[model samples]
Target: MNSKSEALAAAKKRITDLQSQMTAKILAIAAEVEKLMDVTPEREVRDFLRVTCNLPSSELGTYMGFGRTLKGSEALLQKARVTFPVLKALVAADAETRQEIVERMDIGARIDTKEIAVVRKRLTEAKLTPEALMAQKNVRLVAAAARKRSADTAALFREKLASFALHLRKMNASDLALASLSETVRNDALELREQFTDIFGTSRRSLNKINLNSPAFRVAAANDALKRICEGRFGNSSHYAGVKKWPASDSQIIDVLLLLSGHPVPRRGWVRGRNAITELPPHRYRLKAIELCAGAGGMSIGLERAGFEHVALFEYNADAAATLRQNRPDWNVVEADITKVDFKPYRRMDIDLVAGGVPCQPYSSEGDQLGQEDERDLLLESSRVIAEVKPKMFIIENVEGLLHAKHGDHVAEFLRRVAKAGYQTEINRIRAEDYGVAQERHRILLIGIRRELAGSFRMPPRFPERRSNLGDALLDLMSENGWTGAREWARQRRDCPVFDRQGNLIAHGVLASTVVTRRGTPRTKEAARWGSKGINIGGLPAAAPTDAEASKPGYLPGLTARMRARLQNFPDDWKFHGGKQSVADQIGNAVPARLAQAVGLAAFAAIRGVSFDWEAMLWPGDRGRLQMTTPALYLDQPQLAPGRKKPEQNVRTVESAGDW
Candidate 1:
């Protein structure tokens, strides 16, 4: 018993010592990073830490704040053994509050994140100094009238006015037909409109009159209506007698009004997730999907591997559509203008997902960044399809530029409409290299699921340890045409050290830069990046380096289409149907197959409310074969006799189990 107690005591002491050491190290790093900021650009310093030191950006600010707030207190902090999260709260607190927190720590009081949070909240609510706040013996409830109000009433009211205007635009004549108003209300609205017209100049048609569609008119009308309702100016008047008896067409408008009025409106069409089936339907091959802008079937290939069976693949470009059809003749490839496709017809088909890599030209930096003004922009059209088909979820892929402030209005409107369609949406940024693709391709994923499953979905876990470099990913393809220097070139690439923007080494091997559509001429910076990997970036090569090509004095091999495809994680067996330039464009525009598969698996798990053994399901095993397994509803159900059926069973036994 004494030996066991002594051992436990020693273990506890070691753990405590290690924790203090970690705290000391964290403070040391904070001081050094802060020192760097004095001599270096803030952004560059941040990037160096983020890439080279592997610090998450979310935690960067907290550590940086440590240098400012907790700078001369490293000894006290280490002695207190404060955790990082508690330090974060302290850093955010004011000097007086921080001093109080530190004093408590000095007395050997164990402070935690939640306790600090409560202390901060109490200080805020009481509007007292930290010492005064801590001196209280009993909890005292301050009267609302006596409490200081921190809200900006005018700014809040302006926000309410804007909300009123937006909500009014959502309503049509049918919504207002049964909404009676008193003479006072009508006169107030007219007065408001006159005031607005005076403030904002009238249109040319009528120099003194308000244009109905003008912003001034909408704001005036909405402001008048909202004010009257809030003041109860027409309470119990005949004007509002039939307001509750609105037509069925105004049901949505009613809900919108209830929300704007700060009234509780129960979520419509919300089915409890627990009640939904947790397994694939018995007769279905897999979840049915309709893909839009299916370029070269990259995402389609991934979804297929993730167990999705496409109902249709839509692509307007002829060569790309042809590639899909040629590669998988069994797929239903629809080569037509996606804008004109009638997705309403598929509403009854029970689609589980509507996934697409929407054209990114509208948001990409290489383009004009015209957003909705650009002819190729299909974001709203995608939203329309989601509304019509009402799939359980949807995934729209685009470049990160879509989230730029320049396109804020367009992105916000898209999210608003998607939310109105009974879906909860989130934007996620992911890197292809993090998912085992041999490139630094970053993509923005706009994912939406039915509101009931809002919190159920999570982004796929990253496997940075599984990341591959350019040489390892494409070595065989590089050596395909008997190039003698291929092995040496591959070795150089494999051994190259990758650096961050600040020139700090981040990794041991190089990753390919994002594949681009045009390879004809390389910019100076792009050329430099490729040159560092021992490759020529001028033009696409028709084939891998041959013996004759390698014999040239200064030849640096250019990547072939197959090599580029390999970098994009496309299978070697997959074939393209286009000429050289078109094939390059298709491959460059594709979502990396492995990255897409990871996302698809995450979406699948969320929608089905089932867990996945991600490694077995996604990672290819021996001989490049998938060791995929899916837990089915009828796995343990008794098999029926041949040619026999059971009417009572909800699950039907199949002759063979399906792969994930």
Candidate 2:
């Protein structure tokens, strides 16, 4: 224990020494910067202390090392006045002299130089006069008030400067730094313009006119400036290899610098181009696709993955249209309401597929469920376009609740309408989980095939098996130090159940019940099963659970990270973006990428009438040889009778009676 205490003391002393060294270095750098900008040392020190310590302007005088009011310390106050002209003027004038001048100025009474001298002489003779003292006090009070107002104004100006600095850093122009200057300082703007022009070799007017909003322009400027700075500072030598290794585009580097400096540029698009996969190999068949009620590019991304080249996309939201334009520069993202968009333009195009996920609110349980009455039922426009264009196939996806919708008759009527248009349709429920996503989402898919191709069309098979578990997906994401409950909810965890290494509850797994969202309202077992009274589980304290608490069963005691990951079907590499609520929402709304990939591959197979042998595609040279025990091909075989087995364990299973 004695040795441990000695070691701890030594460590603490080392830390204190390092901190002092860092402080000295920072102060030295600040002094050098002030000298370069021609700013006073005292003003520089004040600015440095305020920023480093995050001290407010009101507290500046109090924290100044000197044990005196800002005005009382004449020597220090004068130094400050160099950077604050108003403060200088106030400090230089005597209180009685100032009041007399103010009175004369206010009443428009001009005093001769001889009268001023007479008054000054009388005040000196009578060392203590009530009227004179009162006048002096009032002047001093006015000066203090003015000083306070100046401080407030200076603080606001500093905030603006900080914000601008942050913005410039984000733009990759970190060389520019703001100087603390009095309002009376001349040529500040000229100096800034000259410095910028000299560094970039571009005129101030031209630089100001460049559109930072355009990604192309921003990227170009960022790249050019970075190259210039690197070449000028490091020379054309291999020693500068480290500088060239930075992965961020010049614009991104600048943007980050600006943010750190205190200015944050407003992000414009979903993401930069470098982040997105913009190209893919073309499909075997020339699939001319059409988007119905497309809002931005959400559905478009899926359709493109499914081997469909969109010939036209219809959207009504103006902002969504702009977003589409920003991403897909050449796409025909028509900004017309689906109801008003005429189908005549597409009649002559060789349309192969019509794909869209119609809006769900009208059929949603939360809505009035006025299926046909809801104006959103204008899906008839999509059907009308399909009828006119006479596509070979069409697909419509919607929320699962649509299956049990009261407007079953309306769905039947719509089917009849599509039949009249000469197409056969099949409706099925698809669970996103079965497709390999972590989320247990169910969507209704309506597939319509032209009568001529009805016999050839077969629904894609379900995933052969579950590829991963919840634990497998999220194990990498758990904190290395282990979980810590949220600050507000930390106390609650004391009474909450805990999980063992294998994720089994120390207590029985059985609980009251799970919470669910129904008709947009959260329903919990706490209200129905436990009444308003709460139960204490294990050693934890009990509190009344709200509607939100009921819906979030995972937030309850003993819920493992793996369970949450399983529900979302997230890939091992996929990470949650927001806090717990955001993670939950994304998991709930996103389609599993694995499931999407499987569906995309299956759709491609159905369209081409071929199977995708993953092993064969990966290694074609081992076509005839058995490189590994695993088979090269996978198929959806029917279930067999109990106790039945294939002649070879690796061979495909034979279908039994009623297997279909």
Model number with the top TM-score: 1
* Model 1 lDDT at residue 550: 83
Kindly list the per-residue Cα lDDT of model 1 for residues 1-660, writing each as its tens digit: 699999999999999999998888878888888897889767556655653455777778877778779888888898988778888888988877788788888888889888777777766757876676655422344434233331343334435434544454455654344232445434443554444344344543331254332344444433444444434432323444455422123334344334443544443332223343223223343677889999998899888767686767789999998898787765667788878877887877768899999999899876689999999999999999899988889999999888776676577667768888988887789999988788989999989998766787999888888878888888899898898778888788888887789999888778888887874577788888878777787788888999898888978888889888888888887799989999999998999987898898888878765555666555634323223322221222222112222133233222112222
Pairing residues by index, what is the TM-score of model 1? 0.55
lDDT of 1 at 621: 49
Where does candidate 1 have its weakest 10-residue lDDT segment? Answer: 633-642
lDDT of 2 at 590: 37
**Tens digit of per-residue lDDT, candidate 2, span 357-462:** 6776666654577767788775556677778877777777766556553555456556667879988777766765454443335677677877656655655556
Estimated TM-score for each candidate: 0.55, 0.37
Model 2 bad stretches (over 4 Å) = 1-286, 295-299, 318-332, 467-603, 614-660
**Which parts of model 1 have CA positions greater than 4 angstroms off?**
1-285, 501-504, 623-660
Best by lDDT: 1
